[model samples]
Target: MRVRKIQLKTFKRFDDLTIDLGDEPRKIIVMVGPNGCGKSSVFDAFEEKQKDFRPWGGEDASFYSKAFFYTDETKKASTYNRNNSILIEFYPPNAQSSRKTFYIRTAYRFTSKLNVQTLSAMASIFETRDEPLSSIALDGRLDANYKRLLSASYSAFEAGDKTGNQVRAELIGSINVILEKILDIKISSLGNIMDRKGEFYFEKGNATNFPYSNLSAGEKEVVDIILDIIIKKNDYDNTVFCIDEPELHLNTSVQKKLLIEIEKLIPENCQLWVATHSIGFMKAAQDELKEKVQVLDFSEKDYFTGSHTITPIRTTRKNWQRIFKTALEDLTGLLSPRKIIYCEGRDQPRRDGTERGFDANVLNGIFSEKYPDVLFVSSGGNTELDQRSEIAISILSKVFDGLDILVLKDRDMASGKNTTAHDRDVYLKNNPSNHRVFVRWEIENYLFDKEVLKKYCNLNALTFDEASYDGFVVDIENQNIKDETGRIKNYCGIVSSINAEKFKQELAKVITPEMTVFAELESCIF
Candidate 1:
């Protein structure tokens, strides 16, 4: 049922490779590697040689026949004896009829839009064709599975023992439980077969009676894998369940959840072997399963040159970083931020010609060249930032190890701080290190400093109209415009009525260390 050892020669993508699982293998084995790295070839070898390996049911002895596929035409001169295997004294050498040992689902798993006219008896699991490892063909099983479900209900109806809902509960209730938890939708009804409307319908929110085809590709994949496992558990109870790239079409978070749910459905006696390059799935295996899992890094050994053996790698930070490098390549840098500052603003841009993330964009524009690896994220208004920053930091810490996550708040009028920028600590007095507050009223207030705007005019060869700029600032302060953003917009309109966005951008561009506002802002941020 579980793999102890595997050997392959002249197999697809492998000339000679051996995978040893030691005396007692872990229940969950994750094969991690990049594309074209022989991960799928291991699955192919298992499929071709499955008949020679018998299920281990706590028997003192087990048997395995060596499997090989010669690539060169001349090498095929020697006939391969299918029944030949190295003999050990664990059990009787007399061979028994081959039994099912590997239950595999390839990466090309997909279901078409399905509708059934009549309920038919479902075929046994043994009767189903094992798809070749390379074929990209769709797996048309959802409709057939639906028929089997209806037939089970019809059989229970004829027996007159349980209601229709009860039969469904026995067949697909568990699958619905997982689906509801993941997608917030469940099977509303198995359509009426006699009415010539046999289809699987789903309900999400108040919407009801949607066909199977309406589901997203990721949703269908989730249902397909979980439903297949649930339906075949009785027949494939003690077999090695192999799913290749279970993360296909699913996002990172959903991939993690699906892997966990799939592990729950796999019988305790059976082992789960997953061949994947998904960070989410690998992370779930490492974090959630803990010591119960083993990760075989296929990227470590060069299988093409000659003979080689692979074993599970240690789950350390360095090894995980290498795995991420292999999996994501150049994209790995995007996720690895040395420092992150959460500031107050909305990051999303609206249809109107207004610039968003005024706080975050200004900080990034000013500090990006100085600290290239630091990231500034817009975390909404001050109140929302106060509520969500802690939870967000806790999560980011787990995702990116050793990341410096901090929060920066605006010094609004409510703070009752001195408006003059003489002696204000960037870090809050209550909590010094992680939580910081700006010295000015807000980011926009810093943008509107009279000295900063005068430098902007001087740099651009325009007239230094300090008198008009000061008049606008003085008028806004006299009006007591509490909203800093609206007050800045009014000042921009007075200066450049035609294009306030360009004016703000140009003024931010002119801000440098020469200006007092720039020095004050730099001192707080750095």
Candidate 2:
């Protein structure tokens, strides 16, 4: 079962938002927006809805009535209705069971504070059957739950109830997997409570143990999240998980890995929803979940009707790409490279036999060993490289003080009959310091040098004359390779069975230090 849709009217920042979550068994719904735009409010709305579905038994009120109770009063005057409400519908895999819908109007804070009341409440909730744990987990009140779990495990251990031991073992195993993958730390065992608090013991490569308290704040945060999930794993299946600001206290890499690990821990037939402000986390989520993830943007606005509305921008892949790209651009402080080089290529082979990274590899192969400070970014193709160069230079210039930026495009554009070497030279000269055109027809053409090809073919470079070079080009052209980029790749395969990347590496090693390309690059950099 998974959340099929959510409708909110006058609920906090959401004035009248209706989101349709497709009928997928499992999905990752990512709520993203600026501060106060209602990303967290999404989680708030979910918690409110969950409250109405009391497993312990509660008055069954109309869904609309429950939702209307939670409406934002500030908009009551402008909106036609004063009652605020939210509607949530779920899709169950089993058609025999009746459809479940929830209406909610109450909101509760998911805090992280560890207190006796919180512990007792979580303990009671955990022991209850079919009780949703998302409310507890989302509230940042997992510390109490963690303590209660440890206490229960201890009680079970003393009572010789192997069930408790089994649960602890599973939790420990899961935690270890997450820690090793995210933080590179492994827990040998979870230590018993000492001084009213339990701690995790880390196992060293040499078998020594250390206290979990010794872990950094970031490490503890990761551990806390993993522990929370493990403790509540039994309660998570077929439920909606709403996590607000999950990136808190974690670095970009950790934030990404944590979300991935959490997704893996979630049971099949369940949905994971996250509201976040971190672009790093969003990008990571997109990378990890791909098409399974939906990203919604929240922006606050005042309608001409004098009603305040928190609008949710349509969720689309292109929208997310633009959002992430813009976010990364704004976070220039995180950029590490002092110098930026934009080139036209990607590492993957294109239909044209040229890998999208061919140009990047060529540049990196030659310049990286000597100049490790420069960062080369591939722009996908020659035209894209040219287009992105100005944008990249303009953006990077503002971010990095006195940043050195260079854009390189293949000479392919000027290779046809109408364009001359002078035209290319003039273009290069006009852009002088930051722009350059390949001296050869293309980067691949340079790789087709007789010496490089001979090395792969196990033939002497001296054996390859101008006629051999012409014949090789003719052979490539005659093959009628579909992708222009793939032509060199196809030619290389025919001449030598060596892998393209390896061939490039070998060719790079053989390049003379005094090569014209090297001289040109040096002039541009220096």
Candidate 3:
């Protein structure tokens, strides 16, 4: 039900770019590039093209016939330029976008007069051209049909503690206070609390409110987006929101928050395409250890330990965001638990020696609809204890909300973290639950609270065998592995060789706010 692809031709630096929306899992698409490297140009190509597809603008131009790009030289405009031609192919995985994703072409001349006939030609693609603007529905419009003419036709505004121009760009001018949530920041304002009339105004030193006009140039960029979107609100209808260079004027943190939110705001049925040069924006979409961009992260050796990097888009041919679609999940309805099960790769050999496809049967029993998937739990997918443990903990926290759960943490036997039979017996006795190696704990009771762990200190922390942990390092002798050493040792390639059941045993030890440790997993037998 969502758009799955964006194809480009003759659009700026992307002489050609075809991006896949990843299979099964719907992921956030990130287009990365350096400034003036045509990242924004590619975005404009799509946005401008879509404009022509609309019946308005009275088309003197073919949506595909327009272009707006820098001249061949960095500082000079192209002296002998042609209307930049562009095409955007938007197709959804399901039957939803079948030939439905908007395609547009347009022509731009800052000095040219309006061409009604061209506009009419572009408009004809969506129903009859004779229809008036008020009467014509934008539901079927394509893009290039309008690309070049409306340079900044749309805008996004940002909210929260995010300041400066860049963060503000994410805010598509909304009068709604939801901005507070987007910025994750509190701004100073002098507004009155007018509850009855649904109004709030600026008052110095209030909750982080500022006048739109007074903000700096970068901050105004966000306001500009707000105004643009507000003026062209109708564009969202069956829209494909292609946002390029989202970090244009924002700080790293705000850039990330805004980018993260943009994916959520688009209508689930609507398509979203984004490109960025900032690593902050891509962090959520990229592999955690900088592991994905292995070669590029050569400068710092310590980045393996959750260190941050300012991602550089040095190569024009490389596509950074396009590669990480696997991590994308339409995080829009995160509050609702759409059942997902992350088990061991069904075919890959598991360290637990469990047979292939064993996870499927266990998962089927745990989530059967007759059982109504009441637990709405998931597998902590992987063969390694730590990665599996982390996956189990993360996905459950991110996706589940007040649901019963079953997490099958492998009883890792190869590592010291492995739960011995004695440890397993103790865990079983303490939690009093059983499902072979898999079991449940109520959300209220076992959501892995850091504060709780600090207080009670009863849960089994992830302790490695002193020898194995030491040998792993001593064996390497702090040699050339440098930056990659720590990460290589931590990834699933290494972890999967360890325990499968140890994780389950350890997770069973945490205490929930009210329920006993394993009550939820044990009660599922009914």
Candidate 4:
């Protein structure tokens, strides 16, 4: 199914806002936000627009309005917390006519009442309905006036030991299939899908001794994931998949594989949505779907009201053409294990102490100005890994398939120890270095003796250097400090000129103008 637009009025935090999703067919829609920004509210609001109209579980027709709209108009509080008129116009796939589903959760003027009444489950079609659809087929079909419940209808509870429709061995069978596909796990059969509310073996397979009560938390979550996928894929064309942290209890590999399956398996007639905080996991998933994917940044104004505007950040075709190659090469560079001449610091600051050097503010500086496709980021140090991951993933997901990231970390010049191996492994989840330098170190560290340093650990040179690149090698000198804090009181000597120049040169190889645009994504979290 596809949505035309969504209008929120007096929803929880929004006073009045409308979002025009435009005409897009069966495409995945990713909405990201900090916690409590009403991203889930958007999904919940969509549930209210279903044909059965029992999403909120209230008996009275007006009950949904009051509960889902802003509570007090004077205070500008709308129901569902987003507080904007929440309306969605949806068109089901395989439809011959221009039939659609529209839901509005806004206050309507009451002729006799003093206050306006909130409206929800306000679905309408272009052709007009003489009476609201009363009964729907539970076998997974809907009449014309009623649209299927996208979010509410799909849920996979923990496997309870039961054999009937509520919980069954079928769930375990399904889970085994997924585990086999993702984690390469294999077994004759698995424990049953249980009714967790009672914590009993609601369904037991004849071959199994007992239920999944003994299964590990990770295994249970594996079942949870498999069940959620099956339910969401039930009526693939009509399902509105709302997965909350599908990465829950999953390792990076499983997370990436599951995301890949969902992207490939979900029918093209339906849209898929996921909310997650895993940067590395997302990087892997984005790579799997690089050629066919779209991401929308909902980081701005999670709630909208009067003139409620959502800043659209769509990863488009232009974005792919712009940043894909550079990101890949950067990632490949990091995977290389040689003497990575990390260039850093000022290129002799201009009169303003910003124009000429490695000023991060200047998008067209060393990295971006120098590299068109490669992505080199000024991480400053190890503290920026999380923020850098987020920025890097968002940008690279738009351009390439995998994370194209190169983080230049400073290993004390005097000590001669390499931090590239340790730091790169922390983010990439795999040791990326065989030696101190990388395979692609030459691409960025041309001015510095990166090739020579890998062989000799003795040079780091850049613009305005007093000595050759050989003077800056980290390990050749074997200076000081791998203490508990890994610090040298006189770090003045380690943060020398040779290493700084190498840092800048490495940055100059990757970050391009397009990748720099991601720097302006208006991050709400670091």
Best by lDDT: 1
Give the C-alpha miss distance for residue 382 in model 1, angstroms: 35
Query: Please, what is the TM-score per model?
Result: 0.58, 0.51, 0.36, 0.44
Top model number, TM-score: 1
Off by over 4 Å in 2: 23-26, 55-84, 92-140, 151-171, 193-197, 203-214, 299-322, 325-329, 332-526
lDDT of 4: 0.39
Q: State each model's C-alpha RMSD to the native.
A: 18.8, 15.3, 19.3, 17.5
How far out, in Å, is residue 336 in model 2? 11
Winner on lDDT between 2 and 3 is 2
Candidate 4: where is the Cα deviation over 4 Å?
51-84, 91-175, 184-187, 190-211, 301-306, 311-373, 376-526
TM-score of 3: 0.36
**lDDT (C-alpha, whole model) for all candidates:** 0.68, 0.57, 0.36, 0.39
What's the ranking of the predictions by TM-score, best on top? 1, 2, 4, 3
- Local error of candidate 3 at residue 177 (angstroms): 1.5
- Which window of ten consecutive residues has the lowest lDDT sum in model 4? 105-114
Residue-level lDDT tens digits of model 1 in 404-522 = 88888776634554443333343365564788777665676677777766676566665655555566667421233334434454443445544545556666776765668778887
- The candidate with the higher lDDT, 1 or 2, is 1
lDDT of model 2 at position 114: 36
Q: Which of the two candidates, 1 or 2, achieves a greater TM-score against the reference?
A: 1
The predicted structure with the larger TM-score, 3 or 4, is 4
